[model samples]
Target: MRFLSRRLVMPNDLNFAGSLFGGRILEWIDEEAYIFASCQLGAKSLVTKHIGAISFETSAFQGDVVEFGLEVKRVGNSSLTITCVVRNKQTKQNICIADDIVFVYINPETRKPEPHGKTKAELDAEVLDI
Candidate 1:
């Protein structure tokens, strides 16, 4: 499933360079992915397993609205892979600052990989595309 959302980049998200901090961006990505995955699976408790390969390219300034484009790349029997790209929207430009974010999530109560509620073939189709 695809979930696209936007959030305001306020002053608190900025660092000394007048751009958003790396930690804040990471936190936002995690929160957004968790929400997206849970909403798709109709689950209440979503726990993060692994978050890997984060790269920050362009920096975002304070007051810039960030766009997060999210999708489910691959879903396994017990785990789902979600990808997200964050962009800075400014002056008639949608700049893709950082992308290719991946997250593996699990069921919080069971402490195991969460089912993606999709068939293997369906999951594979998404995997191939991503």
Candidate 2:
């Protein structure tokens, strides 16, 4: 798993009630997952093509530092499913925030999905049940 640590909650990240908004954290999930997956794929570049089901299990108020971990769950012919787990760094408790984001690397010139990385370690990683 690739860990994206300590995305500090900002005032703009909060709702009217002063709790961190779900959308902000959700966006971070997709972004971080894409970065992690792209690094794993050794892709020159990648873009999000799909966002799968998502669930938010806790609340993060202002000043909370959120940690999101990304892992490749499955790889298809041209698409990769990246799973992200969000956790609360302050409380040291798991929030279980999750999403399956799909990214396709593009050939800068052709703007198409192109295979890149082929390292044995990256190809062998499995999604942890956590």
Query: Which digits, one per residue and each the tens of the lDDT, describe model 1 over residues 38-112?
Result: 665556566666676676767778788887877776666666667777777554243343334334445676667
- Find the candidate with the highest lDDT and give its number: 2
- How well does each candidate superpose onto the true structure, as a TM-score? 0.74, 0.82
What TM-score does candidate 1 reach?
0.74
- Against the true structure, candidate 2 has what lDDT? 0.74
